[model samples]
Target chain A: MKGIRSVLYMHWRSVGSWVYIPWLILGSVFLINYGWRSFHQDSQSTNDVGNMVIFIYLFTVAWIFNGQLFAFASGLSIKRMHFVLGSVMAAILISIGSSLLLMLLIVVENMTNGWGIDWHTFSWKVTQTFAYWEQFAIYLLVFLCLILLGFFLSSIVIRFRKRGLLVFGVLLYVFFLVISNTSVNGFDHEEAFWTWIGQHGLLVFYSLIPAIILLLFGCYMLFMRRAIIRS
Target chain B: MHVKLSKVRKAYGKNVVLNDINMVLEKEKIYGLVGRNGAGKTTLLKIIAAQLFPSEGTVQVNEENPFENEAILSQLCFVKESQTYPDHFTVKDILLTAKATFPLWDETFCQALVARYNVPVKLRMRKLSRGMRSVVGVIIGLASRAPLTIFDEPYLGMDAVARQYFYDQLLADYADHPRTIILSTHLIDEVSELLEHVIVVKEGRILMQEDVETLRAGAVTVTGEKGKVAAFIQQQHVLSSQTLGNVTNVMIFGTISRQERLQAEAEGLSFSAVSLQKVMVHLTDQEKGSA
Candidate 1:
């Protein structure tokens, strides 16, 4: 029971304390944007804020990834697997909670503005068509997926502390940004992989599911790793 | 609080650190684990603490395997020279965490030790000097009050005065709590007075395990002319020998009777009791030369 208590306490110290830093940063950015938009009477400015917030969210992921991961590594003693599981699970829960709360705020803002959410748009349809609990559940799932991605990256960093992961972090950011911003081809060909990924019925689910499963598996492997054996 | 290590072996790639070492540690006594640097003292302690798993054989504590076994480890406290903690935690925070983690942790004892050592509780662990950090470690080890407490070179950065204080406090506390305590230190003479049992380790093998009093009782030193000393040592197990001009002093294990003492004295010989420190050094040196 004391061991469990120690694990939970360590998790709270690492993930709980760090959860506030990114939440505050993202919360403040949203507050400032809401104040600016209200002052300027410009409805279009809100979309720009939403887009900018994505990069901020990514940075928050990097921050949470770094701090939570090092704490996880520090907590590793005799039972490396148990420590790693506690850490990765704590990180996942915190990241999901943070993302869900922020998404709820965004949806509230949209509803208060009397805007009609369009079903044809992927983001707007999910926000509008689903019932309150269903919408919340969907957002929670998406949040869990992203948090898993963050945890996966953190585990990779631990595995490669000898190699500079800072470079890898920057490259990952750029890769995600490019994938989100453009089609897979330069000439805008209809045969582009990104076009197919965006339109296909099964490809989207397939790609997303594997990423989630791989991340969870990576977290599992982190627990089983024996760094002391190497030492 | 007994540890039974059976055929324990640890290796790294091509090099072996501990080799088929079998040892038994009983309850309610102080044991001094003596060995040269890299002679597997720390490795042996770690194995007993369950911080490491042996490559072969078994280390059993309380009739169960130690690795991943919280029941045994919860009762054990191990203090190392380079113990690590997070950079964010101050010395007070680490102690607080330890208090929460260890069921038998004595916070009052820790606080008293903090005051006695004059440690700055508010200071970050990383900012503290090496000596001060060692003091913090000592405080933790003493205050943990675990059933099995193992301290490995605990006073490395401490001065003679502080080291003496540590030994005194350790003996004083141990007198009241009679738990199993194993101290691995290079300062043999300073701790020999407190040790109940001595386990001499050499080249990953246990050279000897005997009560300290018995070890001391069995050693005798004889000084005489070189010829007489040589003749006397040839008939006994000579541990060490020293020569000066025509005089030779030989340290040998086993008792020397009054008749033998009188005979040697008549042949220009001097006899005296050998201390534990002298015996340990001689034994270790003898081992090294043979190796």
Candidate 2:
């Protein structure tokens, strides 16, 4: 607990350089998408602009594997447990911050009615179908789960270095082979998998939150406890 | 404030680096950790600082294991040569971060050091010149004021002038605030006078650990006529011997008292002290030749 406070404070500072890029890009996309299409007045043609969540999700993927912070904090004599705790706190904060930004974008979109061009970036299913509060909760959950996945991945990479990712890929490929090779009554496995996801996409993704949290937290603690300081 | 290591052995898979190293670092004394390029000096220092885990042995800092113990870790500061700050961090950012990490953080001292070193506070750490980057590390190590501060070649790219400034600052600061400081560096003679105790590590094994005075007393170079030098070193552990026609010089690891030196001087056997750096070289070379 003595070091935890310092670690928690370091979280925002650690990601300060990285937190703005995604939103800036999303904002540019919003402005440009409207500005370019405004002249054309293509309200009839659908604008397939990428979701802001794409950028938000990608931010964690890059931010999670920052080995420099580990070495930096270690040199400063931060305990491994404290570093991991701080990493979790950083992930939570980033996820919450990202959710808030998304909420702001949604509010702006609703106020401006898709920026007056019928653009739909943050106006996805969660914005239209769910209540405002539920929308924020869903956004928060999606962010937390995605960032948790990133954290778990970064932990694996740290524990094993470059070979860890290679090992993971191989194991995943082997698992896919095993799954695809398994067939019943001449039915295909890949087809069955996509059919399951198609029927229960929301249920499967929502249920995975607890599993991801449990696995990520447990594995990150175990691996990072013994993590070495790599140059 | 005392650190101890018992039968410490470190290896990566089968490539053993340190083996059977037993050492005791007493409190409030400046120690010089001297070794060759790959002689496990940095590894041993990291283990003591708990930035690294020892493969097989125990490292006790302040009579307690430093690993995962924030109370002990907070008491120590490890300034690595390759210590990295966040790429976006400016000098101020690094100083503030260091301040938060070290409980004994002295803002005034840090500010003074910043101005003394002439490091630009607005420039990002990654963009600074190599020497300036090292200056940042030096500033942090000095101002952190941890009870047990370990510097593993923290002045990697510093020039001679900056390095002298560091030595001067370090000596001045250590005099004002006594603490256990271990400086692991290749520049042995540059810091020979500042070191109270010297630990010479050769090929992962401690070649010797002695007080600086004792080390200076242990090895002496006897130069005189070839016959007299050879005769005097016949029963001594000769570290090196060279003959030049009618004259010979030999370095032996045995103390000659004042009377002995006076008698030897009567025979034209002039004596010169073997520096810690020269002793380290001869010791490491002997090991290499023997192996």
Candidate 3:
């Protein structure tokens, strides 16, 4: 248990200062609001640019993980298994923790009446369309998936180093190529696939969470076992 | 703690780094891991540190496999020359983290070293000079108080003063807290006196492993007439030889008897004790060419 706690603490510290992530999320909100408030003639117009800012934050956090993984494994006095378990725990913390913080900011925004300028960064229509608890559940799901996506990408990037990035790019390009070619050449098959996806969209998206998590975890385990510090 | 490696083989894509190596390290002794560059010194250390997985056999620290073994790993600290810390972390941050994680951490000693080394606590690690960064590693290693600590060429960047300070501090601290310390270095002569044992590796194979004094006493270089030196060196393992005019200097390995020495002296041969560094180089040098 001490080893696990130590590994978890190391992972959190590797994420850098405690304030970095929160500041990244909140600072972006305030800066964008400052800019938006300055430019807007009509203050009533609502913008949900927080989603875009938060997505960038997710990407940056994932890159930090990739940068720190090698040293993170050997730095603290912990086994790779402990690190793996602790990382999964940290991932959940980041996901749920960031989600809750964003939700709280939205509550604060409501209290302050959107910083006195009706900036709807956190209180956007997509989230507000749902009931209170439903809204909480929705962000929880979204943030979890977003963080998982970040972790998956980071795991691949760190596990294989530069080769992983090249492969990722190639795979994405091939995927796009396949989609464009099939859609243009055979619209009927594409249309049928879309109809099926529409019928089971929620189920497909939800199932992908575990599939992505499992795939990343598998790759992480296989590579990190033999991983050497790339000094 | 005891560490044993049995038939360990590490290779990468047909390039063998370590080959069929077997070794056992006993508790509470300082060891010098001596080898030339590209001699697989770091690789062997990494294996013992469990930062690397062996390709063939088993490595056990304290009678248990160290690979992902928390019980064993918690008792070890492996410091490297090129360790990287997170960008925003100060030296204080690193020390604090180390203190928190390592159960046997000595905060007072750590802070004392910090002051002695003059490393600023508030400055970010990235901003520190390479030498300063190395001092930080030295501080962490000394203050961690792990039973088995390995420092692999981490003093490469330190100046003479800092290096001497580290050696002195290391010796003083080791005297206070008796634990196993392995200094893997090419600078053999500098640490020869401090080491209880020496392990010499050449091209991924153990050339020799023995106590420092025994290893040094195992060889003697005799200088005299070429014929007398040749006669005396006969039936003895000749490590190296050089012929300067009539004088023939021959480094003979293994011990020589009192009668043999008297006979050699009577035959006009004078003996000189070989430095451990010279012995290491002579023993490992493939072109130990006889002149």
Which candidate comes out best when scored by lDDT? 2
Off by over 4 Å in 1: A15-17, A23-43, A46-82, A100-222, A225-231, B254-259, B286-291
Cα lDDT for residue B167, candidate 2: 92
- Report the lDDT tens digits of candidate 2 across residue range B63-144: 8999899899998888888787777778887787788889998899899989988999999888999889989999999998
Off by over 4 Å in 3: A11-18, A21-29, A32-35, A110-119, A172-222, B289-291
- Name the candidate that leads on TM-score: 2
Q: Write the per-residue lDDT of candidate 2 for residues A1-231, one digit (tens) a residue.
A: 646666666655655544666666676776787788788776463435356545455546544544666767888888889888887777677778887888887888778877787665685653476677767777777777676666667777888987997998899899888766664334547677779988876677668776777787788789889887766
Write model 3 residue lDDT over B181-263, tens digit each, in one string.
99988888888768999998888988788999888888899999998888888888888889999889988888788998898
Better of 2 and 3 by DockQ: 2
**Model 1 C-alpha lDDT versus the unseen true structure:** 0.69
Task: Rank candidates, DockQ, best first.
Answer: 2, 3, 1
lDDT of 3 at A89: 75
For model 3, the DockQ equals 0.52
- The candidate, 1 or 2, that scores higher on lDDT is 2
Tens-place lDDT per residue, model 3, A39-155, is 774736565656556655664665566456447447655676666666667766766766677678778777877766776677557556555665565566666556556666666
Q: Model 1, B1-291: lDDT tens per residue?
A: 888999999986778988978888899789999877888898888788776678999999877887766677778788877566666567876777667666678888888889888999988888998888889878878887888888988887888988898899889988887789999988888998999999988778788899999898888888888988898777777887789999898788876677977887888878888877777777777453242
* Model 3: docking quality category: medium
lDDT: worst 10-residue window of model 2 chain A: A45-54
Q: What's the CA error at residue B270 for candidate 1, in Å?
A: 1.9
lDDT by residue (tens digit), candidate 1, A43-161: 34223434234434643564454444344233222245555555556655664676567566657656655233211111333245546565555555555555555555555555555
